[model samples]
Target chain A: MELAIGIILGCCALGAGICMGIGAIGPGIGEGNAVSKACEAIGRQPESKSAVTSTMIMGCAISETTGIYSLVVAILLIFVAPGLMVNILKEAINLL
Target chain B: MNRNKRLFKLVDILYISMIILPIMIAMVIKILTTPLSQGISISGARIFFSIPFPVQDLIITEAQLNSAFVLISILGVCLFLTHGINSGNLTTRHHIAEWIVEKVQGLVDGNMGEFFKGYAPFVTAILGLSGFSSLLSLCGLFPPTSDINIVAGWAILVFILITYYKLKGGFLNYLKGFTEPIFVMAPLNVLGEIATPVSMAFRHYGNVLSGMVIAVLISSALQGLSSMVLSWLPGFLGEIPFLQIGIPAVLSVYFDVFSGCMQAYIFAMLTMLNISGAFPQEEYEMRKKKKLLKIKNK
Candidate 1:
C-alpha cells in the first residue's frame, strides 16, 4: 500500500515538473521576440511608443495564455490530484 | 522642487494605501474562511464562516447568483447617480462620463467602421462589467468572472453576435467557409469557431482564480516564515504575523491591478476583433462605395 501511494505521488510530482518546464519555453521565446521588436519600433518612432507598447502587451498576453493553461494543470496535479488519489486508494481497500 | 517631489510621493503612498486597505480586508476574510470550509485544520478554523451559501437546497446556489446580484446593483447605482446627466447643467461627473462614452465610440468607429459604431455602448458595457467584476475582488467580494458559467454565458452572447453577423454577410457564404481549402478541413474549421469562446472564458477565469490561489499561498507562507523567525523572542509576541502586515500588498499589485486590468483589456479587444472580422467584406464594400461617390460628386 505504501509503495503504491509513493509511486503515485512520485509520478504526479514528475508530471507537474514536466508540465511547467516544457510549457514555459514557448511563451518565453514569444515574449522575448515581441518585446525586442516593440523596442525597435519605439526607438524608431518615439512618439508611437504608447501604441507600440499596447499592441506588444496584447500579443504577449495572448501568447502567455498557453503557459497559464499549463500552470493550471501543474497546480491541479500538485495540489488537487493527490487528495483524489488518497480517496481512490481508500475505495480500493474497502472493495477488498 | 524637492518638496514637491516628496509631496507627490506622499500622495502616491496614500492612494496605494486606500486600494490596499480593502484588499487586506478581503484577504483576512478569505484566510479565515477558505481553509475551514475546505476541511483543513488550522488554529481558529472553527470561527470561519463560508461566504457561499449551500448549493443543494436551491435550484441554483446563491454563490454565483449573489456575485451577479452585486455586479448588477453596482451598475444600477452608477446609472442612478448619473441619471442627472440629461436634465440640466453639465456637472463634472457628467462631463467625464460623456467623454468616456465618446472615446469608446471612437474606438469602435475606428476598428469596426461607421456601420458598427452603434455597438460602442455594447462594447463599453462588456468592458465595464469585466473590469469592475475583476476589481471587485479587492473589496473582499466574490468576483462574478471567477465563475466559469458566468464567463461562459458572456462568451455565448459574443458567439451569438458573431454568428448573427456572419449569417448577415450571407448564409451561403458562411456555409461555404467551413469547406474552404479542402473538404476535410470543415470539421477543423467548425472546431476552430467553437474554440474561440471556450478559450476566452478559460483564459480570464484561469488567470483570476490562479491569482487568488497564489496570493493565499504566499500570505500563509509569509505568516509561517515570520513566526519561525520571531520564535527567538519571548511569549505571544513571537506568534504575531509581523511579515503579513505589508508584504502581500506588493504581490497584490501585480495579481490584482496589473493582471485584472490587462485581462479586461484583452477580453474586450478580442471581442471587437472577432466581431469585426465577421463583417470584413461588408465593411470594405461600404467604404469603397463612399469613396467612389465622393470622387463622382467632385
Candidate 2:
C-alpha cells in the first residue's frame, strides 16, 4: 500500500515535469520565429517598427496559449491531482 | 511633442490616478476589514422570502469583490471622460478619443468587411476593457481580466452573438455546420465551435493569472532572499522587499504592457474573425466587388 501511494505520487511528479518541459518547446520555437521575423521586418523598415512589433507580440501570445494549456495541465497534475489520488486511495483502502 | 500633447499627457496621468484612487481605497478597506473565510462580505437584500428567511452575510470572494470594485471604477471614469465628447471641440482628449475610434473602425472594416463596420464599437469596448483591466494590476488592483469568470462572461456574450448571427444567416445552414464534410465528424465540429469561446476565455485568463502568480512568487522570493542575504545585519531591516522595486517594474513592462495589450488585441481579432466567418460567403464577395467598383470609379 505504501509502495503504491509512493509510486502514484512519483508518477504525478514525472508527468507534470514532462508535461511542462515538452509543452514549452512549441511556443518557444513559435515566439522565436515570430520575433526573428519581426526583427528582420524592423531592420528593413524602421518606420514600421511599432506595427511589426505589436503584431508580432500578438502572434506570439496566441501561440503561447498551447504552452499555457500544458502548464495548466501540469499544474493540475502536480497540485490538484495529488489530493484526488489520496482521496481515491482512502476509499480503496476503506473498501479493503 | 507639442504643448497640447504634453498637457494632454499630464491630464491622462491625473485621470488615471482619479480612476485608481477610489479603487485603491476600496482595496485597502477590503484588505483591512475583510474576514479570512468570507472576505469582503456584502449583504444582499432578501429575495422572495427565499427558502431561508433571513440570509446571512453574502460572502463575496476577495478576487470577485476587488474585480467588481475595479469594474465600477472603470465605468465611472469612462462615463466621466466620454461625457464631454459630444459637446466639446476637437481638444487633445477629443483627438485621442477620435484617433482610437478611427483605428478601431478601420480594424473592423478591414478585417470583417464594411458590412460589419458597426461592430467597431463593440470590438473597441472589449479591447479597451480587457487591456485596461490587465494593466490595472500595475496599480496593485486584482485586474478584473485575471478573473476567469469575467473573461468567461465576455466569451459567453461573444458565443451568443456568433450563434445568433449563424442562426440569422440560416437555421438549417447553422445546423448543417455541426455536421460539415461528414456526419461522423459532427461531434468534433460542434466541439470545435464550442471550444472557440472556451479557448478564448481560458487563453486570456491563464495569461493574466500566470503573470499575477509569477509576480507574487517573485516578490515573495525576493523578500526571502533579501532577508537571507542580510541575516548578519539582523532584524526587520533585512526583511524589507529591497529587490522588489526595480526588477518587478522591468518584468511588468513585458507581462503587463505587452502581454495585456496583445491579449486584448487577439481577443478582439478573434471575436471579429469568428463573427465575420459566420456571415454568408456571398456578403464577402459582394463587399469585394463593391470595393473594386468604387476604386475603378475613383
Runs of candidate 2 exceeding 4 Å displacement: A1-10, A38-54, B1-22, B33-59, B86-90, B281-298
**Tens-digit per-residue lDDT, B18-43, candidate 1:** 44454455556556556454531211
| Model 1 lDDT at residue B170 | 60
Error of model 1, residue A6, in angstroms = 3.3
Model 1 chain B poorest ten-residue lDDT run: B40-49
- Per-residue alpha-carbon lDDT of candidate 2 for residues B196-261, written as tens digits (9 for 90 to 100): 899899899878877776776676777678777777776777666677669978888888888888
Q: Report the number of the highest-DockQ candidate.
A: 1
**Relative to the unseen true structure, what is the C-alpha lDDT of residue B290 in candidate 1, on a scale of 0 to 100?**
85
lDDT of 1 at B227: 86
Q: Is the docking of candidate 2 incorrect, acceptable, medium or high quality?
A: medium
User: Candidate 1, residues A1-96: lDDT per residue as tens digits?
Assistant: 888899889999999999989999999999999999999999999999988998999999899888878877887898778879988998999999
What lDDT does each candidate get? 0.76, 0.78
Tens-digit lDDT string for candidate 2 (A1-96):
788789889999999999989999999999999999999999999999988987887688789889989877876787678879988998999999
Native interface contacts kept by each candidate, as a fraction: 0.56, 0.44
Worst 10 residues of 2 chain A by lDDT: A71-80
